[model samples]
Target: MKSVTRSLRILEAVAQHQPVTVGELTKLFGLPKSTVQRTLVTLNEAGWLRANRKDTTRWEIGARVLAVRPAALQGSSLFAAAREPMIRLRDAVNETIHLSVPDALQCMVVVDRVDCTHAVRTFHAIGDTSPLHATATGRAVLAHLPQADVEELLERGLERFNEDTPTDAEQLRAELRKVRADGYSVNRNQYRPDVCAVAAAILDEAGTPLATVAVSMPDSRYDATRLPELGRLVAETAQEIAGRRDGA
Candidate 1:
């Protein structure tokens, strides 16, 4: 189990800082040179990571890591439609933007992200899950899902992530109501203590939410005074995506 944990950390580092050299990874983890290199080799052979062609000694996340990603997100109609709006939102807000799709359960998977240029920013790693009740994107997607789906998640139990994370099913339901009413959701240091995010859902013609687009920033830059304006920006971006047809 410890070995598996170490390998996952290495994979995370590779994902976080792609094209990272073995020496840099070893220093990043404060692990032995041999161990880091060994893990990198294993991950590469497993197809979860790949060596960078420009620098054979460095590595980047590989295709296999995206094997589980939703097909709609990969240069497909959904991707094409959402791309422009997501990029525009990122440029408009100057904050990290996330595009996520909800799972069958209580988590939402990040499908795309645009990082802020600021030195301080939150990185929502793609292909990773974030709890529904603790993330703005999560809540945005969840709010538009079938009521039975919401109930099923409540039955699965809401694991607390931080002080601001909503654990009570009733409370979360109330918030979902507000998300539906307002057409947006906001998380203030809910998932990560230092991060705040605002999100809006992108729905299909059937009125079902297919995904969410969110903007996140460090708490240091967050201002309660600006939430409404930022919320509007994110909601408008999501609406734009929702207008695109599946064949678009």
Candidate 2:
């Protein structure tokens, strides 16, 4: 039990200061170097932490650690409550459906998804993260975040994934404002030139955005003429999820 407690503490410390070094962990935990090293090795073996591949001197949260989600976050059990509605929306549109939440990495991570059976469809795997400025799924969540958090994320600078990605902070700021006004978000070949998507935010009881529900399809099948209709469809589905979450 003591070892489990220590492991959790070390895990939290590593998460707090990611890409941390062995010497730093030793100093932070007030443990002898050898003891810290042994603990780290044990945790690494159990898939809780890993030495950074780019810089082995530093450590990072492992893949398994990221994959293990608790039942709820921020007092919201959104994933379980969102499943049926997501599947319904996917069937209605016959497109890939993704439920994403803004994560610690300043991006949106897919928490759940309903796959599209069409030969040509957009597929985003669970646990995959997308840039806030490049995907509708992300921007839908970002548009509702606190002002300070938005400013801080823009200050960090956007990474250009493709030609359509908004690298300028002001440009993304303007786009996010549009998202708020439109009550939904649309990504037209921004994340991938061949893909397009629409998204709407899911708010909790207090109207705080917790996650986003999205639909994505290939650009070849995208209909700009029906874009507004698609957006409305997504928005209504998201609202349904929001209603269920709030009632819960």
Candidate 3:
């Protein structure tokens, strides 16, 4: 029990200060170096922590932790900042709004949602995962990521979930470019059949994407003429959330 507690604490510390060293963790916990090293190793073996790619001596939170419990971050500043804006976006667009964070370039995990009053609407449960190349929420974040990282993900193969899913590398790159230019992404039956969505990424102070805010609805209700309006609304909401998150 004591060992489990120590491992959990070390994992949380690694998340807070990623690429941290055993020595730093030891100092923070006041534990023996050997004990701290053992706990880190245990967490690493369990897929909760991983050694930094450039520096093996430092540890960071692993993909499994991000994949399993995105909802656990509901208490985080990002979630707190996004909640009201998401609601307002939903009210304005009359569509379900989602807040999703990237999962190490593997996919986007939904962390929060604000549902619309429509009887027929699209929905993604909290913790739902979506492909980066196929969804508006996913591409909104993907468009802002480093090109090398984006290339690495594309090299893994873009599985076509629907006819609209952009499988060609050059074509997807073009779409990403448009996303960067437009400040938002649009999905028309791309990931899931008959679902349409518009989304924008929330960026950190470094201009790196932190999460995405999306407005989703059934294709029957989608109006091409409303794209500009809906896109603008989602983008502004995302910006507001980012500002609030940074305490600006």
Best prediction by lDDT: 3
- Pairwise TM-score winner, candidates 2 and 3: 3
Q: Which ranges of candidate 3 are over 4 A from the true structure? A: 1-64, 67-71
**TM-score: which is higher, 1 or 2?**
2
Please identify model 1 stretches exceeding 4 Å from their true place.
1-72
Model 3 root-mean-square deviation: 3.8
Worst 10 residues of 1 by lDDT: 63-72
Give each model's clash number.
0, 0, 0
Cα TM-score per model: 0.71, 0.76, 0.79
Compose the digit string of candidate 1's lDDT tens values, residues 1-248.
99999999999989899889999998899999999988988988887888875577889877556546555457667677888888889889899998887654535778888887999888877777778878898888888888988887888788888778899999999999999998899998888899889999888888888888899999999998998899899999988887774557
RMSD (CA, angstroms), candidate 1: 11.8
Candidate 2: give its CA RMSD in angstroms.
5.8
Residue lDDT tens for model 3, 1-248: 98888888888899899989999999999999999998888887876788875588999887568767766787789989999999988888789999988877767888888899999989898767888999998899889999998898788899998778999999999999999999999999998999999999999999999999999999999999998899899999999999999993
Please name the candidate that would achieve the greatest TM-score relative to the true structure: 3
Each prediction's whole-model lDDT (CA): 0.84, 0.82, 0.89
lDDT of 2 by residue, 84-112 (tens): 89999889889999888765334677777
**Candidates arranged by TM-score, highest first:** 3, 2, 1
Angstrom error at residue 223, model 2: 1.0
